[model samples]
Target: MTDQHAPVVVAARRTWIGTVGRGHHERTETDLAAAVLAATACDLRGLGNDTPTDDVVLGSCTGPGGNVARAAALAAGLGVGVPGLTVDRQCGSGLAAVIAAAQQVRAGDARLVLAGGTESASRAPQRAHRAPHGLTPYARAAFTPAPWADPDMGAAADALARRRGITRERQDAYAVRSHTLARAAHAAGRFGPESVPVGDRLDRDERARRLDPDVVGRLRAAFTPDGTVTAATASPVSDGAAVVAVVPESVRRDLRVPGLRVVATASVGCDPALPGWGPVPATRAVLDRAGWSVADLRAVEIVEAFAAQVLAMTDALGLDPLGGDERVCADGGALALGHPWGATGAVSVVRLFSRLVRAGAPAGARGLATAAVGGGTGVAALVEVVR
Candidate 1:
């Protein structure tokens, strides 16, 4: 194993079981955090380790009191002595936590770490929308607002599609494929292992359910009064959590854990006014850092925050249109499966894990994951399936 500090390599390396909150449980942020921690503890038990974690890193976009990580660690049965920190990077929080944790291990500051994210969009904080008063006339007119753009994400998606020549019909078609693949994967139990059952009432409530095309077609657009982007094509507000175990390569060898390796990871910022295009630069950065071409990737998982966003990146990356069977998010994406902000990153990582195991893909088989965030920030990670 490389030295903990001054290591030349850093990777996500290992993942534990991923847990989702009860779909119908109506859980609070605290409840969801506790549930995720419990699930992580159970996973650690499966790995046959009783040692206290060196550190805990939790991510939540709308965490209450901004202390979800510490609260979760304490609730999960970890000793009070264990340290924890919380992170919020909007939709990319989970991935950001993973990245930060891996860096710590690589930097030698930590050896054993628990990294994951949780969010209860159902319990999202309510705040009065306020406009900045200090901005100059030029800035006020030209600048986008916080929490969301002035016109909002849906509106931005609509404008982008129009500018990029993407049609409403094409976006709808992508949504249909998302539902179909999601339904098939659920039926076949592709997500059975990765998903943890939540709530005492509902034994299992996977968010990726089948959608009615007729009902989808009847829905009105959200952003544009007469635009094409509808709730059907956009990700739903949901509650969920996912956790990963990060350990040094040497420690992984000692544990004898299978399937451990890192490929590439990158983050980038773009024009906040045109936030929908954030993933394009982020994807390019990851590929450039890893010295791999798009064609070299076996599968891609671009967070479907919006249909047009995914469509825009597909074109930018020169990927096949969503209709093709070869494209990623084969089991649907945020649109059909739901996006729990903080948990979405881990959700994507878990999906990639399932895909690799199912295909029995060889080592070096590349998978790319990317997400666009609120502040024109985007993150991308590349993983190679290890055998």
Candidate 2:
């Protein structure tokens, strides 16, 4: 009963994620995004379709001000006919872009699209407004207006951990598990198929193993005074890009390629003060729309913005396999892979593609990807394997 005209993600790829100021320091968002775009385009063609892409939809946060999607599209040699759009939903930006592209394909407005996200935190220093007296700098952008409180992600995570009763030891244990899984994946070459080398240099993550419990145990709180949340529990500010080719199901049929079929997507709003809870509602909505429950999902990916936040989500969602859930982040998550804010959501999708599609899961096998945004929003997509 699969819809042949529905949009399917046939190819997914990402550049090696790096710590903000170290590996990709000299590369802009455009440079990193363009590399993956080009690689993903090759994937599209290799699947036996050279039809020019209809559009480029990308998401970014704190990138070089202008329209980075358009710039990256041209830089990737997509030609002048293809237009581009950029979306920003804070940390949810990347998944939002993919959902936007799927909407276009569903409406028959476009046949094929490239969608994902990119971020260059190192290159994007704090921006300032042109004041009459001089320049006024702000630490971060405002997500809410008066009356409502919008604390930084670090502080919010600490508060959320305490409110949710997530112990610091549990968070530290999860952190170690993430690194352990990621290292196992890397040693087995699990990342090579989906990861592209950046700048012909080290194409690996820079900050994970430093989180030794003895070491992490001694580290002080990063945001709140006397808080349990520490550097070891939070994802680092990182830089990277990821892209996927979303094509009509007819294309997948024609190419004889197995891919993830876009089934349903949901976005929900929550209290700005507790943005991490956004995923709880968003995931529920998407699953309801798809007529599928957690028990039916073969794989799930949730951005690991913080160990406490991720644990809260898993607990709320009733997913019981907490210690080593192969169904959840079998390879790793942002904790070990590095969360390039805007790009991490798409990276989630890419990981699902690798886990389900590339691994040859049975037809109709389902997977999910979700992310919690800083602006009190959550986005989730339900996809199925079509063989």
Candidate 3:
């Protein structure tokens, strides 16, 4: 492709995140993804036939082994002819899926694509191996090589917190801020625009209202007896889905879809031991590719798998973590909203979409959405308002 067309996100939407085994406990992963995909497609429908998309690309980590994307596409009534691709790349899967869709558009193989991620922690099947003897419950899947020292995500976060000198107090404070902002945003109806209600009610984020300062301060370490990481500071397991409509810039005018144009994308590998720091390199790489600086971005959304994870990235990137800076997750983050592993990264993109496109921010407003992966990888993308 000589003159590759740039990719742009025209529509974005997400399901109201619900606590695991609560609001969406009965919903399947395919159904959640289909719901969000249908909402996003409906958002595009206003553009008429110009909104036609070529495929559906989805991401998941704990979903059933088969091609969940195909199931979701069919369930969403996207037509049996539309091909679907499913990707699993740990925590970064969602953003990576969006990047993959954008690449297809850039390569001219697709004019429009539906890309995002979904997760149903409540409905995820418990793993167990059948054996001649009694079956043993599976604890977790390997995320890295045996030699790389694979630690459970919570333990890894605790290790990073200790290494970075991030105190338990700091993590708790950050968690409090997340809930405060998220609740305030919710009360102001800020989330209504991007979130779709589910199951006979306008579902709200269950974790956003669970803030208790004294309770958080007294919580014990979740992974280690003396570690800093705790349940209060970590993102809760939740069920939800989020997706975006990606179209080539060539069709933006014809479709009258005003949104963010993709500027650059990056996926970088890092040390598996310190997974929380992955976003630092990922964001830097994307900015370098676009020849832009941190100063160029008006907003940033680095998924908060844990409060310490976000703080570590802020420190590495020279951002003010406690200064009430509006550039970083102005509304809130996963700590308050809950993290549906596979969908968390795409939720960050939806945050950017709401801030840059729906909020009527100044023209050319730029934002970067980035995330750290479980297996020593970081993924990020830089985008700007097309107007």
Error of 1 at 211 (Å): 3.3
Candidate 2 residue lDDT tens string, 64-179? 67899999999999999888999999899999999999998888888899999999998996778899999999877898887897978888888888888988888888888788
> Pairs clashing in candidate 2?
none
Local accuracy of candidate 3 as per-residue lDDT tens digits, 1-387: 213388989899999999999889889889999998888888888667455669998889898789989999999998888889999877888898999999999999999899999999998988888888978789778888778978788888998898888888889989988888899999999999999876854368877875788999988889988789988888999999999999888777677657888889999988898888789899999999999998889999989999998998888888875787778988889998989988888999999999889999876899999998887888999999885
Alpha-carbon shift of residue 86 in model 3 (angstroms): 0.7
Error of 1 at 93 (Å): 1.1
Q: Over the full model, what C-alpha lDDT does candidate 1 score relative to the true structure?
A: 0.69
lDDT of 1 by residue, 104-175 (tens): 877778876777678876666554434586433221122346554554567778877887887777788788
RMSD of each: 5.0, 1.2, 1.8
| Steric clash pairs (candidate 3) | none
| lDDT at 20, model 1 | 36
**Ranking of all predicted structures according to lDDT, beginning with the best and ending with the worst:** 2, 3, 1
Residue 8 lDDT, candidate 3, scale 0-100: 88
TM-score of each: 0.85, 0.98, 0.97
Candidate 2 Cα outliers beyond 4 Å, as residue runs: none
Question: What do the candidate models score in CA lDDT, each in turn?
Answer: 0.69, 0.89, 0.87
